[model samples]
Target: MRTRFPIAICFVFGIFTLLQYFSKHPTLTAMYAEILDWMQIVFVFTLLVGVISIFKIHSAKISRQERDWPYSILTILGIVVMAVLGFGYGTEYGSPFLWIFQNIQVPMQSTMFALIAFFVASAAYRGFRFRNKEAAVLLITAIIVMLGRVPLGHQISDLIPQTAQWIIDNPSTAAKRGILIGIGLGSITTALRVILGIERSYLGGRS
Candidate 1:
C-alpha cells in the first residue's frame, strides 16, 4: 500500500504534467499554475527536511567522537548561525547575513575553485599525455584552445586564434549538440518510465 500510493500519485501527476504541455485549455493552464505554486511549497518543506537530515547526521558524528568530528561542530554552527542571521536580521543589502555571504562565503567559494583548478590542470596533464591518436588530437585541440585565449598565441601566429575559433564553432558545437540530444532522449525515456511506474527505485527498497 505504501509503495502503491506513491506510484499512483506519481502516475497521475506525471500524466497531467505531460498532457499540460500540449494543452491550451484554460482549466489545464490554471491547474498547471497551481501545481507550480504547490511545487514551491513542497520545495520549502524539502529544504527543511534536508537541513534536519544534515543536523542529525552531523550531531551523530559529533556524539560518536568520530574522526574529524570537530568539523561537524563547525558545520552545525555555520548552519545555525547563518539561519539565525538570515531569519532574524533579514538578508537585506546592509544585513550581517549579506555581509557574511559577500565576504566569507564568496571568498571561501573562490578559494575552493582556485584549489580545484590546480587539480583540473593536473588531471589534464595526465589525460593529455600522447597515448593514442585520439589522445594526441584532444591534447592538440586543448592546447590550441588554451593558447588562443591568451596574448601569447597571437604573438606566436596570426592564425592561431582563427583556427581555435573555427574548431570551437564547428567540431565542439557539433559534439555538444550531439551530447545534448542524447541526454534529452535519455531524460524522455526516464520520465516515461517513471510516469508508467516502471521505474520504482525512487520509492526506495527493492523494486
Candidate 2:
C-alpha cells in the first residue's frame, strides 16, 4: 500500500502535467497555477527541514568532539550570519546582505574558479603529453584551438583561426548534437521507468 499509493499519485500528477503541454482550457490552466503555488509552499517547508537537518548533524559532531569540529562551527556561523543579514537588512541593493554577498561570496567564487582553471590546465598538460597517436592529435587540436582564439595565433597565420573556426562549426557541433540526442534518449527511458513504477529506488525501499 505504501508504494502503491505514492505510485498512483505520481502517475496521476504526471499525466496531468503531461497533458498541460497541450491543454488550453481555462480550468486546466487555473489548476496548473494552483499546483505551482502548492509546489512553492512545499519547497519552503523542505528548505526549512534541510536547514534543521544540517544544524542537527553539525551540532552533534561538535558536541561529540569529532574530527574537524572547528569547521562545523564555521559552517553554523556562516549560515546564521547569512540568514540574519538576509532577514534583517533585506537583499536589496545597498543592503548588508548584498554587501556581504558581493564582498565575500563573489570573491570566494572567483577564487574557486581561478583554482579550477589552474587544475584544468594541469590536467590538460598531463593529458596532452605524447603517449599515443590519439593524444598527439588531441594535443595538436588543443594547441590550434587555443592559439586560433588568441592574437598570437592570428599573427602567426590567418589560416589557423579559420581552420579552428571550421573545426568548431563542423566536427564539434556534430559531436555536441550526437551527445544531446543520446542524453534525450536516456532521459526519456528514465522518465518512462519512473512513470511506470519500474524505478522504485526513489521510493526509498519502502516497497
Candidate 3:
C-alpha cells in the first residue's frame, strides 16, 4: 500500500503534465498547474526528509565514536549553525546566513569542483585518442573546444575561434537540444507508468 499509493500518484500526475504540454485541453492545463503545486509541496517534504536523514547519520557517527568522529561533529555543528542562521540570524541580524553561505559553502563547493579539472584532463589524455573515424572527429572536436575555451586558441589563428563557434552554435546545440527533449519525454513516460501502478520498483520486490 505504501509503495503503490505514491507510485500511482506519480504516474497519474506525470501523465497529466505530459498531456497538458502537448494537448490544448483547458481542463488538463488547469490540472497540470494544480499537480505542479502538489509536486512542490512534495518536494519540500522530501527536503525535510533529507535533512532529517543527514542529521541522523551525522548524529549516529558522533554517538558511535565512528572513524572520523571529529568530522561528524563538525558536520553536525555546521548544520545547526547554518539552520539557526538561516531562520533567525538573517532576519534578526543583517544577513548572517548569506554571509556564511557566500564565504563557506560556495568556496568549499568550488574547491571540490576544481578537482574535476585534474580528472577531466587525465581522462582526455588517456581516453580521447582517435582509434577510428568517429573517434577522429571526436578528437578534433575536443582539440578545438579546448583551444577555444583556453586563452591560447587565438595563438593558432582566427580560424580556430570561428570554427569552434560554428560547431558549438550549430551541430552541438542541435544535438544537445534533441537529447534534452528525449530525456524529458522519457521522464514523462516513467512518471506516467508510476502513477498507473504499472511500475512498482518503489513498492519493493514483486512479493
Candidate 4:
C-alpha cells in the first residue's frame, strides 16, 4: 500500500499535468493553478525538514566531538542567527538581516570564489597542456580570449579582440546552443518516464 498508493496518486496528477499543457480548458487551468499552490506549500515544509535535518546532523557531530566539529558549531550558530534575524527583524532593506547578507555573506562568498579561481587556473593549466592538436588549439584560444579582454592584446594587435569576439559569437555560441538542446531533450524524456511511472526511483526503489 505504501508504494502503490503513492504511485497511483503520482500517475493521476502526472496525467492531469500533462493534459493541461495541451488544452486551455478553464477547469484544467484552475486545477493546475491549485496544484501549483499546493506544491509551494509542500516546498516550504520540505525546506523546514531540510533545515531540521542539517541541524540534527551538525548537533550530533558537535556532541561526538568529531574532527572539524568546530566548524559544525559555526554552522549551527550561523543557521540560528540568520533564522532569528530574518524572522525577528524581517528582511527589509534597512533590516539587520539584509545588512548581514549584503556585507558579511556577500564578502565571504566572494572570498571563497576568489580562492576557487586559483584551483580553476591550476586545472586549466593542466588541461591546456600542448599534448594534442585539440589541447593546443584550446590553449591558443584561451590565450587569445584572456588577452583580448585586457589592454595588452589591443596594444599588441587590433585584430586580436575582433578574432576573440568572432570565436565567442560563432563557435562558442553554437556549442552552447547544442548543449542546451540536448539538455532540453533529456529533461523531456525524463519527465515523460516519470509521468508514465516507468521511473520509480522516487518511490525509494528501482523501477
Per-candidate TM equals: 0.89, 0.90, 0.72, 0.85
TM-score ranking, high to low: 2, 1, 4, 3
Give me the runs in candidate 4 sitting further than 4 Å from their true place. Answer: 24-26
- Top TM-score hit: 2
RMSD of model 2, in Å? 2.0
Local accuracy of candidate 2 as per-residue lDDT tens digits, 1-207: 988898887787787887887989999999999999999999999999999999999999999989999999999999999999899989999998899899999999999988988899899989999999999998898888989999999999999999899889998899999999999999988877777777888889632
Q: What's the lDDT of the predicted structure labeled candidate 4?
A: 0.93
TM-score of model 4 relative to the true fold? 0.85
Residue by residue across 170-203, what tens digits does model 4's lDDT show? Answer: 9999999999999999999888888777888988
In terms of lDDT, the poorest run of 10 residues in model 2 is: 198-207
Q: What are the RMSD figures for all models against the true structure?
A: 1.9, 2.0, 3.8, 2.4
Query: Which candidate number would show the highest lDDT if scored against the true structure?
Result: 1
lDDT of 2 at 44: 100
Model 3: per-residue Cα lDDT over 79-162, one tens digit each: 899889887866444589888888888999999999999999898887788788988889999789879877799888878888
For model 2, the superposed segments whose C-alpha errors exceed 4 Å read none
Number of clashes recorded per candidate? 0, 0, 3, 0
